[model samples]
Target chain A: MSTMTMAKALNAGLRRALDANPKVLLFGEDIGKLGGVFRITEGLQKDFGEERVIDAPLAESGIIGTSFGMAMRGYRPVIEIQFDGFVYPGFDQIVSQVAKFHNRTNGRSSVPMVVRIPYGGGIGAIEHHSESPEAYFVHTAGLKVVTCSNPNDAYWMIQQAVASDDPVIFLEPKRRYHDKGEVVHESKPIALHQARIVRGGTDATLIAYGPMVKTCVEAATIAEEEGRSLEVIDLRSLSPIDMVTLTHSVRRTRRAVVVHEDVRTLGVGAEVAARLGEELFYLMESPVLRVTGHDLPYPNSRVESDFLPDVDRILDAVDRSLAY
Target chain B: MSQPLQPWGGPPGATPHADAMTASDEMVQLLTPEGRRVEHPDFAFTGDDAEIAGLLREMVLARRLDLEGTSLQRQGELGLWPPLLGQEAAQIGSGRAVRDADMVFPTYREHGVAMLRGVPVGDMLALFRGTSMGDWDIDEHRFGQYQIIIGAQTLHATGYAMALQRDGLIGNPEPDRNAAVLVYHGDGASSQGDVNESYVFAASFQAPVVFFCMNNQWAISEPSTRQSRIPLYQRAWGYGFPGVRVDGNDVLAVKAVTDWAMERARQGQGPAFIEAFTYRMGAHTTSDDPTKYRLSEETEAWRRKDPIERVKTYLLDAGAIDDGWLSDLDAEADALGEHIRSTCRQLDSESLAHRFDVLFREPTAESEDDRDAHLSYLARFEPLSEESAR
Candidate 1:
């Protein structure tokens, strides 16, 4: 076991993936000698050589479209979308070509590629810097959307995402990247698509992912003192949400509340609510409620607590669900 | 037939001329505005009378398809159609010149090329009708999808050619199996970074690809003058490749140039740049109003050099195709127009249930969840039948 930050864990995970698969390549702006702006890919280019860890041109669409061609030619390219906002220039390649290559080829071609974006808000950053745009990928079909909540999961989930044959949008919480935790480096691997139950309770289930996972867990601790048991499920995989785990939790608790840092309107929470209503309708005590961010761009850091779903907001939603 | 003395940076095998005329003179027109064919010995056409008639038929059918598609867009049957009104010769000539094995990458406005490639007219309509993005398999059809982003297809073609070369399909020691790729883009697209980068890559790698630029004189509201000070094709010389200007309004000239380039590529020669100089006789698209920027006389001048009429006149003068054959071709064109109209109507009313199926080959957990949630939500309004319900 090794104690490391989420950024360090992700770096370790990338190293392991490179060691395991000779075909795995890493490419992005400043990812070679510069190690990336976050330094998550530090020393990778030197260790793996320039072919495997490429420092591509500052062209997002060029990087992505050529990577799609490379993937067609049988290479698993792990691309880093420099920032959340910078991904729009490459949106055409991602949505039109990379996302559709598999289905368009009828399984003859697969984009076994991972586009890593360091996203979400809480950092005192300028405009276009701290935005949570995971909903766009989640809304897009043929893409597997997943995000890591802590160091251990960040370490394991990245390798798993790379190993999967599907194209994955692996979102890294830019704010929580420095948070430290103990990660078990193991030979045995976990499935990439399953949700993890971070905390178990009998009252109501709190489903959160990425940066909101820690907040939901903290909310559960406060709820425990108030004699209300809150089950917190960290939805690791956003797109292929482990609905089995969610359905089972909703069945036992008979109530559900989803939490996320993204805006509330048509968010992933809405999909979860609608799905639970369809599959576990009779078992529910109340309608599925969502404790999410305001329907606005991530606000200034001074007032970000109001925009984000903190512990009190999550617990309040849990209490509201129980009252119903 | 006398070959015009080659000016500097013109096609090979000619005496270089001093003080070549301006950019306007660089538009090497072999067919006059009055529909007379001038001959250049070096770039002469060896195609028989039957081949010329066949090329004429292709240009006519391509025009008919373009007319029908534009009408569909106007009638609200299609979301948009980039009208290929006056550039029929450029598309048909270049599209037919390549071998069956050679690949083509086209911009969104290559309806004429799509027709020549035998892509079903209905399948082309799907994209404009908003029923689907593109409805053909690129590998199976040998024609790439209509890339909307300008100049991006050039890079794809370069990459495909490089892959082909790497796979020993081009530049082999036997020298018989090499293939070429014809990638199409417009004058405005020549200014984009990707297009220039593609040129650098293709030249550096000596990939078997042809850069076909249809300088249609206008890109939406921007005139050809706004795109470049010199003729677009001449820019290829800077990239270490031969470039030439052809009368894009003349089907014979277009065919002669493209055929030579494709042959060169197949013979283990590197890339060639062919600029088919033509005019856009209509608005850029259904939503565009061309009267805003273009003068009426410019349209009238190009109208006199109509590609279909030039071939028709040549055929009539030579007695290659009689009046009866012309009448039969007109009937066939009318039937094709009607077929496209009816098929477009049918497509609008038909339910596109497979829209999501092509979203992924193997459904990811997210797509599966999304599919399940969408189906259940849809079931609330329209309950599935017992036989089909899950």
Candidate 2:
């Protein structure tokens, strides 16, 4: 086991995927010589050469469309969208082409493409740089959405996503890129599209994913000190939404709080809350509460703290639910 | 009948000057507007009368399919139809250029090209009929799913071409081992960001792709002139590839250029662009009204340059097929149309219930739940089929 940051873990995963298959291609803006803005693709171009690791033109739609084409031709192309907000230009290709290609072709053709976008509002950046666009992707049908909270998940999930036949929207928690953690690289990685219970408890379940998972875990520990045993569920997959694990946690706790940086309205949190209400209606001590960003344009980084949900916000939701 | 007798792309009220042919990279034409064979300096139609007749025959069949599709839409049998009324030769010529191994990525209106790609007339109408996008399983066909979004497939084709390049399919010692990609778009789509980006990537990577832009006078309601200040083909020069403007109405000219271009790509010469200068002789689709946006005089002018009409005229002029033969071909085309009508009618109305079936290679737990929920909801109504309830 090596102590590595999420960035290094992802880099290692990309290396392994490249080493595993010659047909696997890497394409994005500044991914080649620059090794991606986050350097997650560092040393890959140098190792794999220019053909395998491509520095594509600065066009999101082109990156996706071409990747979809490459996938059609039996090549697995992993594309980087550079940033969360930048993916909008290629959203049409993602929703219209990448997602639907498999369904339209009756599962005969699949876009085995991975789109990695560094997401969420932290690291004190500009408007477009810091934004949570995962909600939009989770809404799309033909794609799978996943995120990594720590180094191990980052290392393992990147490899799993690349190897997947379905198109995957890999949302990187840009804020936690430097957070160090122990990574265990095994012969086989953990199952994708399944949620893992990071912490177990019976009072209430704190559900979150990607950037919010770390935050929720911290919130659970703080909640423990407050005399409430909180279960923290790190939802790795958003689309299929590891509901089996989520239901187990919610059923045990009988109360839940969904937390995320995405806007509260029709967000991932809202979907979780809706599902819980449907499944655990009689067992619930209270309605599923949500602690999320306000429904407004992601503000400039100076005021981002005011917009982002934090430990205090999670505790407040926990308090509100316990009162019920 | 086409006002002032001036062919398009020239000065108003003037036939394309004889100097026009010699002026630029002369558009290679094997058949002229007058139905006479012409000799070109660079390209020639090497096909025998039988093969040439096949081209004409396919064009007629495609045109008949298009007419039947339009008629079907008018009679409420279809929701919409994007008629390829004038761009038959451009599609057929380029469609024929690709080998069985080579792939095609075409924009939505390439009905002729789709027909050549092994999708039948009725299967193609499945899109217009609101049954499915296209009836043929897109995975099984050499052609891609008909992309409605303009200029998007150009990049996809280039991506596929890039793969072809990396696979060492291009420049293979064995001719049959080599393969390339041909993508179709239009003048208006040239202005799209995706189309331009596709060019950049294809040129940068030296992808074996041919961008066949049917500059069919109008892009829906907007004119081609509004889309490009200079001739469209020259735009390829800016992207670092050889580009040509071919006679879209001249089947031989299109086939020759496309063939040469695809061969050039397989030889690792990078991508090639061809602007098939034609006209939209009919409305863009069943929903569009040409009278609102264009003049009838202009339509009359384009009708004179009709691709199928010119091919028929050429065949008759060469005594390739007599009136009796032409009539027999028409009878066959009508029979095909009848088959399409019957096939469209026979398609199960509730086929959309199987929407969840093709969603994934294997159904995910969530998708399975969704399917169950949907089926349960449908069962609340009188179960259309006894098996649908479970």
Q: List all candidate RMSDs to the true structure.
A: 7.0, 4.9
For A10-52, candidate 2 gives per-residue lDDT tens digits of: 9999999999988889999999989999998999999999999
Compared with the true structure, all predictions reach lDDT values of 0.82, 0.86
Model 2 clashing residue pairs (backbone):
none
lDDT: worst 10-residue window of model 1 chain A:
A65-74
Candidate 2: tens digits of C-alpha lDDT, residues B33-62: 777778887778788777888998889888
Error of 2 at B266 (Å): 1.5
Which stretch of 10 consecutive residues in model 2 chain B shows the poorest summed lDDT?
Answer: B14-23
Instruction: Using TM-score, give the best candidate's number.
Output: 2
> How many residue pairs clash in all the candidates, one count each?
3, 0
Please tell me what DockQ candidate 1 reaches.
0.20
